[model samples]
Target chain A: MSRIILYTRFNRFWHWTQALLILLLAVTGFEVRGTFRIFGYLRAVNLHHGLSLALMTLVLFAAFWHLTTGEWRQYLPTRVFLKEMAAFYLTGIFRGAPHPVRKERTAKLNPLQRLAYLGFKVLIIPVQFTTGALYFFYPNLNAHAWPAGFLWGVSTLHVLGAFGLLAFLVGHVYLTTTGHTPLANLKAMLVGYEEDA
Target chain B: MTNMTSPSGPIRPPRPGRFIQALAGLMVLFLPVLATQPPPGPAHGAYGRVRAERNRDVTADHTRFKVLQGPFKDGDGSAVTRACLTCHVKAADQVMATRHWNWRPAATDRKGYGKSTHLVNNFCISTLGGNQEACSRCHAGYGMTDRTFDFTKAENVDCLVCHDTTGDYEKVKGGYPNPAVPLAEIAQKVGRTSNQTCGVCHFFGGGADATKHGDLDDTLLKAPRSLDVHLSRDGAAMSCTDCHGARSHEVAGPDYGAPADRREQPRFAGEAVSRMACTACHTATPHASFVLNRHYRKVACQTCHIPAYARGGLASNLSWTWSTAGRLKGGRPYEDKDANGLVTYNTIHGDMVWAKNVKPEYVFYDGSMDFTLLTDPLPATRPVVLNPLHGSYADPDARIWPFKRHDGDQPFDPVQNRLVAPWTAGPKGSGAYWGDYDWDTAIRLGMEKAGLPYSGKFGFVKTSMWWPITHMVAPKEQALACGECHSRQGRLARVKGFYLPGRDRAPGLDFLGWGLVLLTFCATLVHGASRVLASRSRRNP
Candidate 1:
């Protein structure tokens, strides 16, 4: 077995911080909506707003870092080996099969991981930010031409986006456990190194 | 011209002879066309003077009429009415029969069973009190001495109180709220009434400005458009009569109780449009959004539109306590006022609480109200609802409505179980509480006058009344957002007997929804784990 640098220092920082912020946002957001009441509604809303700002800032910085380091292309989805990787998890793994694709310093994510992450980066996360921002600055929104239910609709959409985020989070957590050893991928993310499976 | 003598007396000349001189000059100049020109229709000149009346259909100038040109021309209200009714025979009969003159209104529906006459209210209990003159300060007539006041008397009907076009007619406080305006002047200048005409009494009713109705006040006279768009002079400039349409002297509207359901009825000419509903102007589906249109079915327009009442900075009477009335400071009848200058205590009436910008409590109301009458049996334990707005969630006529809750502490006969309206305003011999400060004597006289039994012993009980809040509508921007109501503990949280989304939890339904999501998540984790375990088993085998 050989160890390689699978994650950069900045990548580790962004990943950990983004995860922390997302988790905080979800907790405070649910509290504001009275799903659970750890913090009161007013404070939960205030903290939710602050955490959203921090997460948005991190997103901007990570986007800049990815573009500058040419690491933005790492999440580009490919059809090649995508079907095979899914099959390995569902069936091939049961037959004492080897992993379908190998991990590397330049290309750490399998095709399935790449596609899922790509959707998170492009659609899910961006949508969350848009809806969050709308809620945070809802008083400033010019709803003159909007229908009477316009604000209600926007709030409903924001709640839906939160549920979407939770689903993605569950899938992400589960995929982390799919590594050869459960802590193998977690450690790689923490210290920026991984062993070939 | 020779001095003319009338049947009643010697004729008096017109007060403004300048007008006659001008008319003479015009007549001489227009003499050439007098033979060929078509007759002119009636036209009003400055200060309501008749500028022209060429049409024969218009009545002859009253200044030239012999009955009105007599020695008794500038007489009191009764004398003037007698002369005018000679030509307007039907007017007195119409005016005398109305609630304005009678101080009593007939019930419009089965549930609408009370009027100003019999309403057992927290404001002052009932108008059936021996003190009718004190209450009649808001009455439309001149003198209403007691229950024995004649209604059939034609001379008692004051016409100029409403018909006065000149703003000179004003009701000043005395024995009652008689305007004491000049009869002849008002009669000569009579026409349609203005907002000022209705406002003089209604706005200042219940002893003070804005104390009775939360919706109306002196603020409406010069209110900005934000406060009242309809009454705003800069906006629609609509008078009270515009909405409260009148025909045959009876005003169209409900006064005793709010309606639960009313379809828009068309107002034909010369008929009273009695359905006083906001939907009369704004249709049910006023909003463009389909979702908002759906809300129209269950939620009232006022519930969304009027977020706050008494927004005009004039606070409404929120509560009154008559049990503490006899408290005096320095041996005189004591009076104390709150920060809003509302009378918090009067040695005569007790304590009162006033509030402005109050957020209305919500309820499912159909428009009718059930009042605890004076004769109704008092409950021993529970606080009485003096006036409870009647409605139900399951009722199709019902909609979620907002109301101003006015509460009070008033006296009731413990043994008789009847609410007592003590003689509160009268002379020393009349057993008035204000006069002699004797509760036993006042209660006896009051209960006797009302023809009800009253125990000598009285006890104060807590009561509450609901006044439907349907005014001071905020702008669209100030309306409550959906999150206000569609949440777990929304504004409608207190509302029972209904299923509301966002706030309601259907355990089985919610479990099913989340079960699908949890199932997908669990399946992914289980599938991955099984695959790994199976692959290891295969290697071992």
Candidate 2:
């Protein structure tokens, strides 16, 4: 076994910070959505607004980093080893079969990882940001005679996007354990090094 | 900027100092906006300053002026009114044109929708027929016993009733000062309308103290800050004319117009919008919390600020059953008092109910109101809305307003399908309900006098009247908390047509969303347990 640097200092920082921000936002956002309450309605709204601003700033910084450092390419989808990766998770994992992919410096993510991360960033993130922004500026738009039920439609989409993000979080956390060791991926994200085969 | 290092190497982060500097610069740019926010809580000083700057004492002392220093006889209020008109020539015309003097809108105003003409209220049914003499006690004019009293006469406009500074100045029957009252002494001290002067009529509307408007009462004369922040000496210490804007004898208030929604900010002196609204002095968005500020678009300021009506010690008339009138004890009219010593039953009026600190009924009001006219056929619905406020959640200009809803059962002609106004008070020989104890004679006289057809048949019908509550604002600490209307069984439980977060939820969405979360959790648990078991077996083998 050998260890290699899987994540850089800023990459790890962004990952952890983004995770914390998303978690806090989910709590406040769900509270505002009439889910189980923690902070009062007023406080929940304020915290959600403030957290969204922070997340937006982080997203811009992460976008700049991805573009400048050419890290965005790491999430580009490919069909190579995709079927093998699905097979490994479906049945081979319990039978002690070998993994279809390996950790490397030049190619860090496997085919399945590429597709999942790409979908999250490209589809879910954009939907969330767009819907959240429209929801925030809804009162300003009230003067304009928008179609009736426009706000209702926007609110429904925002709520659905929140549920989708929550489901993604559950799956993402669980899949992290499917690495060579159960805690291996989590540790790599934290300390920026992975114990690889 | 591109990195000078090789592509294979990890990218170097921008210097931390530069990021911190940028953040500091953003905060500095935001400081001015943060400072511009008006300091929270009540805006008492802001309104006070505006009032003080405008209401400067510039008039010559009335005591020194020979025109006012008169040995006017008691009960001679017309003499003082005549003297007032000597200097202010057009004052009578201004007052005469107002609804206060006419007691009815111009005949052109929606076909004369007013109390003395077409409109009918639950309390003191109507002043038509022979009852006009008794009801005219509260009228602004003198000796207006019937329709014959001249409206063009300048001396009939009693200016002292509103402008009198002396607390002793009283309007007896026929809008004349009390015979024993020192009219000469009171005339010299007249300056401006106080809570005492306005309360003489407004507080005693519907025939008794605190019977008409649930927010107004004699308790406001010496109110504490908790009772009324505007009128209380402990607060801004404002008088009736402060917000009402007494310009050219035209007292601007709810009588003029009640716009349910106003987006305009607070106005300074000389920018009088002629509105007796909280927004006249306070901003539309006056809360420190942004969530509360957002509510300004839909919820009226009075809904939260004035949590309840009739908060003063005096109870307001909540319900009246005129059908129960004419109940006499031993062939004589009598009154029945409740355990609290409040008059619950009266032979002249009816069975009545009064409440203090009453929670207001919520309703969407867009400012326009539809009154049941004297000629309009009665609606099929029981407890018919007398003055139905025109609004709904669908109306973008509407806001949820607080109201004092007075319910009653009064005589209506079932055959004609119309409300019958009864002449409530007069001499025994006159066709008055109070004197003759005859509903038939009173109804016939009232209908004939108003020139409206009434069937010989008469029966009682339930009705309700809505009075908008915009007074008795409590201190900031007493404003309703968020939970008051955010819970399932909250203050706004009966208020419909809008979605409230905690009080409302789409059960289908909740079920579907929760079901998915539960399935995901269970799947994770099963998947983890199987993997653990599989790993254990491999190690054991």
Candidate 3:
């Protein structure tokens, strides 16, 4: 049997809440883009805005939790076995080769996963938040004489962030479905647990 | 180790599953309801009855404006009334005569008048297939869609459509009609509701479904007007009269040259007195930088401010239409079967002539071949030059010119001779080459040759002797100031570029802005694709 250890209450809470918020945001965001109008545009916009705000707040709380608890080390990328992990995903997966890296209590992600998650956490999310916040508060900035190309540049960055988020969502959905059972990864997110390998 | 290890492990506390489950149950039972429930009604134990009291309050407030009648009633069963019309009864009459009121179902006989025939039948006339709740909100008055209420006697327009102060118009009557009334009040007595007044009807949701205009949704509405040119940010913010100026009881009347008896006068006399309505606000100086720095005096505000009128069709998009006259000497390819016994061979030779025939009687100067050569310029046959060069000529020197009969001293005396100059003989066999000039090109060339600084290219050549004669002799300074006739507020401004959204950078800013947006959107697609590929490889590995 796999041993259970202290996961810390806030860590589990942040992980589950952030995951749910991202999923909700993705659904509404796509709807707003006119991909499929499941909920009406107004409703979708409301949900998207609400979830985005919630996610932003969760990120703030999670950052505090990570810093105070020193759990931010989990996302620190490593060069060890990075190339092997990349090779395994690119070609070895087709041949049913074993995974090059393993997840443990101390290090929960492979080197490649760590790097990708690090980019998402440190770069992509910040860009999206900054751009979106600026867009939201544009009316308030009316007093300021914006630079000649400022609005265009900021809007472009916002759209780019939107596309990046969309890609991440598609990959996430696909990976979740690719688990041992069709719903195994989905259940792990919901319950905050996974079966031992 | 053997001594320390007992059969049973160290004593431990029982798992707190029950306690946690009880806590979760308590949260589920109590916390969410507490978090989500709206605040309770006022301290009155008869809170359920408060809604009735609120209706009475609204009805009492509305009564101050106008009397109520018909099946319409407030929630408290008081008769519904015309609240807005009470204050703006005079203005309402003027509004009804304008295009805004005419935006309804066309009379069956009005078929040839373009899209005016395509009526939006989406309200009380739903049997006509135009009755949708969404369309009625903008087109018809308020409360038309209330299934529980009958608005049969209600006017198509409501007071709150323009005076949307409180979302519920009844509760907030005193919020309007304060003391800051202007000296010449263009609009009726209303408060500081400018753009907000217009936005009540123009904005997304409420009653208008944006899809009717186009496939536009709420997200599209959120975009700035600069991005979507169809939208007017001002239209969404200001009252109709803020720009339209003065509620005239009369319609725009007929075209400028309509018969006098049939002509309609301006609704408000004051509106007619001042050019301040649309033109004064949209001054000749639109670009602050250009006006200050370039000393570019030639460019008028209307030069770039072209009005885009709504096209006439069901899919009525906005478009601009410009008309130019071209002279063709062949007389529209007509075969003149009847000619004099001389058998004048019809040689189709026509140069784009801009010269008008000078009557013999009005010859301030005799320039025509016959008049100049004749030893004694015959007073009866004396043709004064009507070629624009003759500034003001005597009636005797002018010929029996039909064009001049209606103009100047000839003064179009219908009783004396119905025939006008130029066409005095009615399409005669005059060998004189006469036709319409390409006025746009001719005027440009004339301006340029006269030492006028214009920005546009002149396509035609000014070969007429009249060009130099008129420039040197006529009021040169007055004629050269084409800005007097072509300025933003001039009659030509109305004729040429009918709609100008205040002078900005360029006339085609809308197109340029859209192009940039499209280019950036394409770049985003490429970037997204690359990232997706990179992510897929990482995930697969």
Please name the candidate that would achieve the greatest TM-score relative to the true structure: 2
Docking class of 2: acceptable
For model 3, the docking class works out as: incorrect
Candidate DockQ values, in order, are 0.08, 0.35, 0.03
lDDT of 3 by residue, B138-182 (tens): 532433332222333334444444544443332112112212322
lDDT of 1 by residue, A1-197 (tens): 45567787667767877787788788977776657767555346556766776777778889999999988888988988999998987777667667888887778889999988898888878878776666554434443234545545555656666776777788787778667777778867865666666
Off by over 4 Å in 1: A1-97, A100-165, A172-197, B1-76, B107-117, B172-180, B267-272, B487-490, B502-541
Model 2 lDDT tens row, B94-188: 99987779887655555576656767877887776556677887888888776577877879998888777768777766677789888778778
- Evaluate residue A26 in candidate 2 and report its C-alpha lDDT on the 0 to 100 scale: 89
Q: How far off is model 3, as Cα RMSD?
A: 25.9
Q: Write the per-residue lDDT of candidate 1 for residues B1-541, one digit (tens) a residue.
A: 2222333422232223543454344334323322322343222122112212322355556545556653443325567667778888999999876778765564443443443354577777776667776776655555565667677888666666677777776553222323355655556766667677787777765667888778778888887767776666544556676567787888755556667456556767645575456677666676544345556566887787777778888888888888888887887888899776877888887888888877788988888777777777877654688776777755667788888878878888888886887777787667788888888888888878767777689988898888777766554556776657757877888887654545655445435435655876998778777976786777787
Better of 1 and 3 by TM-score: 1
Question: Candidate 3, TM-score vs. the true structure?
Answer: 0.33
Q: What C-alpha lDDT do the candidate models reach, one value each?
A: 0.69, 0.78, 0.36
- Per-residue accuracy of model 3 over A1-197 as CA lDDT, tens digit each: 34223244455566656666676666766564434557555456556666777778778878988888777898898899989987875655545465676556667667876787888898878998897677555534541245534544564565556556655655555555434444766655543445544
Q: Return the top candidate by lDDT.
A: 2
Among all windows of 10 consecutive residues in model 2 chain A, the one with the lowest summed lDDT is: A143-152
